[model samples]
Target chain A: MQMTDLPPAFVLFAAAALLAFVRGKARWVIALAAPVLTLADAWAIIDIGASTVVPFMGYQINPVHVHAATPVFATIFCIMLGGGMLFALNQKRQVELPAAFVYAGGALGVCFSGDLISMFIFWEIMTLGSTVVIFSGRQEGSERSGLRYFGLHAVGGVLLLIGIVIVINQRMYAGEVDPLAFRHFHEMVSGWTSLSWESLGMWLVLIGMLINAGAPPFSAWIGDSYPEGSESGSVFLSAFTTKTAIFTLMVGFAGTELLIYLGLWMALYGIVYAILENDMRRILAYSIVNQVGFMMVGIGIGTELAIDGASAHAFAHIIYKALLLMSAGSVLYATGKRKCTELGGLYRTMPVTMWCGIIGALAISSFPLTSGFTTKSMIVAAVSEQGAVMADLGQSHNHLIVAWFLLEAASAGVFLHAGIKFPWFVFFQKDSGLRPPEVPWNMRTAMIIFAAFCVLLGVFPGPLYEILPYKGVAAKFGATVYSFEHVMQMLGLLLFSGLSFFVLLPMLKRTETISLDFDWIWRKGVPRFWNEVAMPILQTLNRAQKAIFDFFPGAGSESRLPPELARRIGTNWAVSVPVLTITMMLLLYLVVYFVVPMLT
Target chain B: MSDPIRKYLNLNDPKLIKWYWIVGLIVLGIIMAVDLAVHHHAHFAKDGIDIDTTPEFYPLYGFAASFFLVIVAKTLSIALKRKDSYYADD
Candidate 1:
């Protein structure tokens, strides 16, 4: 490999290593300088369209290569790290920043990976780094939450690895020269709606990516684990993992029809859950899923402009989501509170934070002059544009029509749940009799900077548009992004949504409650089933064994059992017993699926 | 050190809140009214789904959609909602 072909991820990796040992002002220097340097290096690589291939186990793997979407995603990942570091500067937990760096480094690494093997490696690195970030939060239950988070992502990573292995093996058998090339799977795009053995690997890959993107069933992990993070640690956590998955999906599975359905579900799911959610951070976490759903729809549309829209939206989403989280983090920093029920009337003492939070809210709602308006509108326009194209082709596009309407409805829903619910409940609702000062200067500076990006990109989206995968398409769309009719429609939708929030205020009252999601299957349902049903059967079986043993001549003499033996057979194994039993069951399943089938 | 914007932004101030709501509602009304004059291009013209172009369609849809979402969420809460500490207490 050439010296100039170094991956920009090394910059953050070096900084993360240094951050582990550095102290005082030097830590700040490394933290601030790392993202800047990484951005420059990333751009240089992107500008050159560089690639460096290394031989790994008899296969050529490009660990450092720029793809079409690299500039936008890599640039935003670097910017997120910088802004997140700024927000986290005052965080006394020494481990968060370094862990955040490693996490972001993995995300950046994924952006430049030109092969599936490298992508999977970086993907797992992200899971590891982010799990550390959660653990470092030291919040109550953060340990268990982090473990749960890690366990889910580990399963996702395994799915992706198995899919990669199968796909590469299939490609090799087919005599393809480059078996591991990470590019759009055009064949699957055509026949994506139905299942076939040939497309099984791609299907596994898509499910794995969807899981990371916070799609259904797996969606609860975002809200479940993110709220357990420290104020700023959650800020860092909110940006990287899902967006990176979005980057991968845009590359590999663009134009797949199923993503549209999944996206629509995620969009509405985020809103409904956020509406019932009482925790302020969880509310924002759900919105992340909601916004990602918009991007997913655009990727599914799979036109040049649509892909551009998804890329641009992911870029803008990261900034504003991080901004929103930072605002919430600041509130938590000042008051040590995270629930909407416990906060209100903070505008009296925390004007900076309140305004920043409001700006983030407006931006997220795609108000007339914010980043969300400039970026997210592209996705909406793409849906209509694609519908028109299908009409010209004389093909029925009923799904596209439904998708357009649902996306529009989701746009309004975003305003209600996140834009109105977040700020109104946290800053302007009935006073909870708490007066907390503004956050420290570093946090305020971070919030202001991100909030400014929201408006700046909204007003003059030229720079952001230029970096999109389809710059010409984005720039052409940017021309009409602020047209009078478009602006008015968005305003009418969002304003009326705001009105709805007030109109339905009584029904939307905050409660100290959590809504059970699909995770309830594992978190509550599985444990309950084991304890109440499965354990009883196992106990009976054990008792039957003991009875049979007592029937033996010598066994009857020792029926009382030794203390060690009794403890081993005890009923109260807390978590380990169920965990072990489940593990063994999974092992049996593996045996039945692979070894037994092979023998047959 | 003083927060001057608090005087107007504070929700606790009755007069300010009353005027704010009046202005906000008027803005929504004006946007809806303007919908009568402007012709919204049909997004799915080939599919003949031009209902989106009707006057005040956006505002009406926005209100109804959010209302539906809130009601649906509340109904779901009846079955799925639990004390925030449900998991922790276990």
Candidate 2:
């Protein structure tokens, strides 16, 4: 196969291998060039058709193909990787850069995967890569956190595999064409309310994607694992996994009604947890869930505009979230502090970092003339527009109305938690006496690149809208995205929320503490039960067994045992003895039955 | 790290802090006033939820919602908050 004909992910993988042995300036060249090469490879296959297919086990698996949403997601993934690599140029941890490349490559690979098997393979590869990035943090608790991260994704991967197998088997049984093809589950959209056995495979697949999407009950994993990564490692962690899940959900289970409720829950859950969080990175981590929740709602709405909104929002979110983390990561890099309780007043020395951070904060809050305003409003508009359609059909549309109000409230809450809380505590709160110098040039450059994109995309959204899955819908919405009323509404809401932040500032005070999340079940509750409850009972059972043995003849614990008894209790055994005894018994039975019958 | 830039970016300066509050509040007032003049077509007008279209509804909702969320979080924190080392001790 021609070099260009290979899967785009292979370029990054090759770089990763070279990075393992290569050192010095050569590492930098590979790190920077790989992402650019992958970007070119990604953009080259924008046409929606099979580009590369490999036969395996009598089935075709296309590893290089474009879906409708591929162009936008692929473009952003490449850009993120490039920006992330630049930010990490000074990172001394060798494993981190290589791991990050593999992670980004896996995400890009998913964007081009045309079949379920290929998607699952890339999905697991992402899990492996991200776990290493977390491990490469070399933080005190990183190893444990990385294990937990891997464990959760492993379970999620298994669920996805099971679902894919069931789905492919059912398709084959029904003699469907291209049984392995990864596409929308129209049955999920049509029979959204039903939870029958026939649709169990699709349900498993949705749950698997939802777990990675940071949906509730499993959402705590985002906060639990992401913050443990090194500064730059967390930036890479924030971009790929959740957004890839969003891409998969949009493609596979777009109109599932359940995502609406789950998404709304995640949106609010993230805000509450973030408000109470003191760790700056943890706060950003929670907000990732909150942001993904908005994308989930759009996917649930599943109109052409809503799908476009979800895709466009993911594209914008990856950049701004990375920018936010880069700012936070810069702080961590400069001061070795990730807690707001311990960090403040570095903006004096780090003006570039501060301004970039503030820009990210504003964009996240969806302030007018920022990336969020132009992108997130589309999801909100999609909700109300869908409500109108439902009303016209005389179906129950109350839920859509509620979704709209909750989303608006969430927009304001995003301002409260991330937009103001992150910058306010980390940069402007009570001075913790830290006067660290600005982060290095590479990090600043990365932040500025992303910050510029945030503003430019907001001011001119036409280019981004042009690459959306439903370009017509997105373009039409782009025209009204900056409408006078919408701008006023967003401004009024966000500013007043800023007011609320200061008003409730006393309650929102940072403590050197963490609020309990659902993860406590595994992190504390299960282990506690095993140690405190189950272990003692098993020990007692062992004692009781020993007591019974003590009462038997020549088997008493205090007595000198015979050779047979000693062999049994002392764990002495020979494989040939047991085999010989059983063989002799079987032969005797055989002789008595067969020979005596012949003599009679 | 230099003197000129530090002076501009430093919120630790009492003078700068005062200006920040004053400028922030003024911006808030302008936004609220502008919002009152803008007509918001009700998003769920077909469903008769015209309260959403009322003058300055978003600003009010924004304030109340955030206030409520902070209050709820603080209350939950009383029971749920643990020292950051809670898991690390394990």
Candidate 3:
């Protein structure tokens, strides 16, 4: 079929079957083909620009007219889907292939969706598909994690629906017959719009997106669930969901001020929790939040440079994060262990995996000659320029400076914990006698491809810069301050953190236990408090009901009692009936006497 | 054939330790040389490109001082490895 003639939904439907039917070599080919096909479709649709049409509910969904930013995000989503699919090809599980493809398609659907209603429809599908991917781990922990994951996402979907309804209703009240025909993208981009029902719609949409991005409170679910997924399943889990939220945020809420603070909090929270974590995967999961925080902050800054930085960071982060996780997953797959304590000395056998992991780690930490450095520098430089401009107005820009500094500090922490700590402890530290062979060639090939991109983007950022929405920022070669300062800061962090780890090394070791977080409210505290406190109250209520039933058997029983005349003798019946009738008449007389006078 | 250094440091031997230190120093030296020689770009011309000596130069000086502090901190970690698996028992 001609590329333009191929509908996006058609691609999804085809991918679904391809993912379901294939196994072994056939499965690998199907996995690889699905993404390639999706990418091609994405490119074709994006180029045609609202020209490509598909029928949904009797309405023609023109993807080309969907808004300028949608295509950019859709393009990246396609790339990530392809990369993640390739990464998962070597794993034996059949379920993850279909689950991941459906998940990717749902996200693409969201990106190309022209209206709020279409966006909400695809949003829920993405949630269900991702939840299934998590559950496919086939572990008890995964089952529980999947439940929590779905619960939070369901709530987010509800909130998003409410907001969409409100916005549509307001549009209707304003005399617009079709809410979907309203184009608010220009207003959001201009930043001059006032707060109204429409703006409230924007806030609701932002919260919904942040929930997926793993923002705090709601953030715990990503860390809780993604790590519990099967080694291969996690590769799927990592790519689509959070990045999709970021894509939405970029399109819908860029330049909003609240996102800046939210992003900062997420960045710091990730760093703090990661520092306290012992499980290798959880640490990486937290780092995902940390990395997304940078993008969030960039989107919030709203400058052309800042948005560009955010976009570039998202692209870089997806590749490197997946690479990191795959490396960890390989270790888990090979050794059947996930904790840092139970792992060591595998670098001898898994040197290829080790090096691949380190490259990913370095890229994540924004080391020079890595994708992270190329992209993240744009955000920091944008912040610096903002500080300079604000300083001329006689206002303090200390907060901006501090935020930038914290970002730098977090970068150091990433290297200390993830970059160096992961590879060093799991592969090179004290020996644990593990001798698993190198990972399957397909897995290694995926890692190598990602690692190559990490370097390629870092050494040459021009391609990314060109595609970025932001136009003003300068991200090019030969800037010494950017490179030198970041390197020195990273080194300093390493030195200090290294010293601290040694000083507290006695306490830093992994244990055969889980660390508590917000999930603790559900996992331990709530359950314990209920058993010790709420359960007794329930028991008391149960006992009272039982006592009431026992005391008045017939009162609560099914059988009816005989009438008074049947129970009594004839004389007794005559006297009781006359007495009862007289009592009723007298009571009625008394009621009339007292109640009639009072009414008057 | 066991080496004396292996017994003390629990590393491979004196040969390995010497090699590790040599390689590390060589890498560090190369990085420093590159930083000093290739990275410098004069912010101002000799007379034409006006420069703020106080505001610009001070931060650079402060950065240099902090950089040395980091190096010293790293040197302290040599005392820190702690008889391997110090926390392993817990």
Candidate 4:
């Protein structure tokens, strides 16, 4: 019954279960109060050193524990949940709220889980919660996209579970104490080049996390499904999954050498795909991949400063990305259109939304006076800091050097892809004559609060920097982050990049077309294969089985029974197909269990 | 039905659009000058971080990289572009 024993995740989960039965004003009150209460309880636990262990399954597990980085991620998650729920206040989708609770609940569970078993259980819960949220979009193809989203995450979840089992077994075999303890993967990430059992387990774990973080080939899920959500569903969708993956990566795979290469590819990949993309939400979705890439490089750098940078960047990113999505959602709610080709010249009517969208865009581009500047700058600085350390140590840190320049270049590209491009096209491009008013007050209020945070955190980053993993390192870098020289450099780079957009204005024209991506493999390739190749083979096999059965006389079972008796039985219990299937499967399994033992 | 806000924001007007570009050019010029006045030091330069110490290194890289990304995306469009309905059937 102790406050310390209650993991923050369960708090929302309890609320979710409660929320399903509540109606009207009571529901709204609970939605807001759940996060507020969880935040209060979470902060209390944090104050009590955040160490609370429970014994389950013969393991003493710490489900609510804090690392140096935990506070930063946990804080933003609470803030994001609060703001997201507020934005969704007026949404009539009955299931979206409770589903969001479960989604956020699961991610929160992962944040506090102190063991691999606990983490895996929570991770699967998140996949279910988010898939339901996508299905609740109720748009065209919502169910289908939700299915694909479910399928991909299910694959990721299986990889994670298998990795967890292997790593735990390996640790136990090595005679380690507390073998399932969730701690940093220093051995696996730092020494991945040497192939071994531990490294393979860790590599599997890393791949599983990479899939959620929207790292390439898998990056299409964000764009594919996020935009399909009901406007508010997307706001909730944008916050949890990828950012949680970043949190896990920062915790586990910091300093993994290959991440820098993967991160750089994501950075460029985000920009290129966004440029070719015609839908506004898809553009933002690509940029989410892009921003997460920045955080990945920071973790890959693996310095205290870099880790802090990654954590803080994740903190800042959730708010702004959600804010951007909120603005896009606002547009969708008002206009019922989501493509750039269909939206324009509404800045006159929707000044509040336009300004909020602009603020979010600027913050994402790391404009000097926004949260992106205060936070993302640390990661950029971390690369340089790590490069310096590497040079002094006489180690091969050329990757750090390459990473720093690519990051800076990517920063410029952010301005092009998201900063100006999002606001410019959606709000002020051609006059499509759609004159939607500003979004409703609750939605506007949410956007404004987040927009204010974007600017406030930029101006005063002390609160955020204080909570970063290596608190002192981030605090020290905070001063340099806003130096006149650095600010000028960022302005020069981004503003000029803005000019490049205008220079390429004619080339950047909107079209009702989508550029190909790795998703083509799944969305088109898999279905086509199933239709053209697999289905035909299966149909032929089916015909052959039917022919054999037709020739087999009474062995074809139905022929042995009277047709009238069979028809009577079928007609009587046709609704019990699932029951019949389960009974047969259970009988088969039981037979296998007994016979296998005898055979052995 | 004249909207005052639209009147102020309509850069589609030729004169207003001209002024917008002119102001933008002036602002970029001013910021470029500001970069000159500040003594920019490279975080990695003391440890032999060479290329970044060059004057306006970030600016040039930013411009070139953005330009490069745009051109690449455009080129990719020629091959990768499909009608918006390409996946609608699925």
Look at candidate 3 and tell me the lDDT of residue B29.
47
Model 3 Cα lDDT, one tens digit per residue, A1-600: 466654364586577777698666777677677767777777776667535446667655444344545555666677667777776776677777788778878887777766677677778889988898998887547887798899889989988888777777777688975565424444545453476656676557667888899887677887788997888778778777898888778777777666777788887667656655667888889888888888888877767777777877888888899889989988988898887878887766787688889999888877778888888767766666666666667676566766665665555556656666677678765778888988888788888888898998888777766656643344342244245645644444444444344344454465554444566576557777899899999989767745644564343333323456446643222233344457779999999999999999
How accurate locally, in lDDT, is each candidate?
A: 0.90, 0.90, 0.68, 0.87
The complex in candidate 2 yields a DockQ of: 0.71
Measured against the true structure, the TM-scores of the candidates, in listed sequence, are 0.94, 0.92, 0.78, 0.92
Judge candidate 1 at residue A304 and give its lDDT. Answer: 96
**What's the C-alpha lDDT at position A119 in model 4?**
81
Task: Name the regions of candidate 1 deviating beyond 4 angstroms.
Answer: A1-3, A547-600, B1-4
Q: What's the lDDT of the predicted structure labeled candidate 1?
A: 0.90
Instruction: Report the CA-based lDDT of candidate 2 relative to the real structure.
Output: 0.90
The fnat of each candidate, in order, is 0.76, 0.77, 0.00, 0.76
**lDDT at position A507, candidate 2:** 82
Ranking the candidates on TM-score from highest down gives 1, 2, 4, 3
What DockQ, between 0 and 1, does each candidate earn? 0.75, 0.71, 0.07, 0.63
**Residue B1 lDDT, candidate 3, scale 0-100:** 15
**Two-way DockQ contest, 1 vs 3, winner:** 1
Best by lDDT: 1
Candidate 1 lDDT, tens digit per residue, B1-90?
365666777787799889999999899889988888888999987777889889999999999998888999999999989999999998
What digit string (tens of lDDT, one per residue) describes model 1 on residues A1-600?
A: 553488788888999999999999999999999999999999888878889998988889998988899999999999999998988887688888899999999999999999999999889989999999999878787999999999999999999999999998999999999899998888888998779899889988888898999998799999988988888899889999999999999999999988888898999999999999999999999999999999999989899999999999999899999999998999998999899999988887888898899999999999988999999999999999998998999987889888989999999999999998999999999888888978899999999999999999999999999999999999899999888889889988999999999889999889999999999999989999999999999999978755654454544343355667668887432333345458779999999999997898
Between the candidate structures 2 and 3, which one is better when assessed by lDDT?
Answer: 2
